[model samples]
Structure formats: structure tokens, C-alpha cells
Target: MEFDELQDLARGVRQKYAAREHENYGRTWSREEIMLGFLGDVGDLAKLVQGKEGVRPREDLDEAFAHELADCLWSVMTLADSYGVDLEEAFVSTMTELNGVLDET
Candidate 1:
């Protein structure tokens, strides 16, 4: 899928979570709360990475790692949407700048 399509799918999932949060907690998560949740996802991904390296043993580590990475991507896409940033553009620009810097060296 294209980036826009993926981002739309992410937004759909994020809306579902907002509805669940409202039902459970009387309000959806704030931006800060979302960031905190993203941090938790990152921590999980880190542990999964450790498992992949055999530093932390885990059953089904590959599956867990893929899931965690997806979660992190969802968080990043959601955060970018919330902040009104065009992630695709930013990513391309950043990569171009990095390549330019590398070429200069």
C-alpha cells in the first residue's frame, strides 16, 4: 500500500482506540498520553530486539518483534497526523540531506 493509504488505515485504528478510551476512561487520550503510550511501545520493541539478539529469551520472538515494530509505526504516523506534519515529505527530505552530507565527507 502507498504511504497515504497506510496512514489512513492507521487513523482508522486510532479512531477505534479513541472510542474505546472514551468508553473506558470517559475521555480519549491526550497528545501527551499518546506519546507516553508510544514510549511504552518503544520499550516493548527494545525488549523484543534483545530477545532477537538472545540477550532476552522469548518464545515467538520474530512474531512479537514484527508486531511491536508495527505498533511503533502506528504511533509515529498518528503523532505526525496529530501535529499536522507531512511525514512522507519530511522523511524524503531528511534522507536526501543525509545522503548529501555523506557525499560531502
Candidate 2:
């Protein structure tokens, strides 16, 4: 799917989570709190990468690795949405800049 479609899906998932949080905890997560959650997911993703590379011994490695990657992607998309970032534009611009710098080196 396109990035915009993925972003929409991420928003829907965020809404579901927000509703669940409100129901259970009486409040939804703040943007900063969501960013912290994203960081936690990043940590999990790192460990999964290690496991996938055989650098770590984790049970249920393959499935857990894939799930962690998806979690990280969701967190990124959600964060970008929360911040009103145009990820596609940002990604392309950033890559272009990086490639320009690399070419000069």
C-alpha cells in the first residue's frame, strides 16, 4: 500500500488504542508518551534484529522479529502523523541530501 494509505491505517489503529486506553486508564497517551512508547518498541526491534542475526538467542525468534518490526513501523507512522510530518517528502529529501553528501565524499 502507499504511504498515505499506511498512514490512514496507522491512524485507525491509534484511535482504537486511544479508546482502549481511555476505557482502561481513563486517558489516552500524550504525544510525548507515545514517542516514549516508540522508543521502547525500538529497543525491542533492536533485540529482534540481534536475534535474527544470531547475535542473540531468543525463543520464537522469527515471528517475534517480524512483529517487532511492524510495531516499530506503526510507532514511526503514528509519530509522524501526530507531528504532521510528510514522511514521503521528508524521506525523499533526506535521502537526496545524504546521497549528495556521499557523492562529494
Candidate 3:
């Protein structure tokens, strides 16, 4: 999706959460909500990987994990938007700089 569309989606999701803030688990998320969501999703990701030995070896993703990952991405995009950063450009520049550093090393 385009940046504009992603921004719209972020707005919609934020609005949805706002509408049910006090009802659903007593959540009244603000802009910091995005950061908290991102951190929570990251923790979930770590949890999923932490017990690889005990967990069954499977390629299929657990539904909740997928949802958490999507949530993480959405929050990240929102954060990027808040900072006026175009992720596409930053991503490219970061990779390019890494490559240059690698070549130098």
C-alpha cells in the first residue's frame, strides 16, 4: 500500500481502538499506544523464538503471532509517519550505508 493509504489505515485502527478504549480490557491508548504495541509485539516475537527446542518444528505460523506481527508493522509505520520519515527511503539508505561500511571493512 502507498504511504498515504498506510497513514489512513493507521488512523482507522487508532480510531477503532479509541472507540472501544474503556470497554475492551480498559485500554485508552494514545500516541504512545503505538510504541507500546510495537514493544509488545516484539516481546511476543521473542517468546515465539525463545523455546524453539520444545516447540514443534513447523513452517506454519500461529494465527496470533501473525496478527501480532502485523500489529507491529502497523505501529512501526505510524511511528515513522509521526517522525516524517519515509521508510522506503530510509530503508534503502540504511542498506546502502551498511553495504558501504562492509566494503570498507
TM-score, per-candidate, Cα-based: 0.97, 0.91, 0.65
lDDT of each: 0.96, 0.91, 0.74
> Best candidate per TM-score, number?
1
lDDT of 1 by residue, 1-105 (tens): 999999999999999999999999999999999999999999999998899998998788999999999999999999999999999999999999999999999
- Give the least accurate 10-residue stretch of model 3, judged by summed lDDT: 50-59
Q: Give the TM-score comparing model 1 with the true structure, all chains together.
A: 0.97
By TM-score rank, best first, the candidates go 1, 2, 3
The count of residue-pair clashes in candidate 3 stands at 0
What is the number of residue pairs that collide in model 1?
Answer: 0
Per-residue error (Å), model 3, residue 89: 1.1
Measured on C-alpha atoms, candidate 1 has an lDDT of: 0.96
Model 3 over residues 70-95: C-alpha lDDT tens digits? 77778887788777888868978999
Q: List the residue pairs that clash in candidate 2.
A: none
If the candidates were sorted by their lDDT against the true structure, best first, what order would they fall in? 1, 2, 3
Worst 10 residues of 2 by lDDT: 50-59
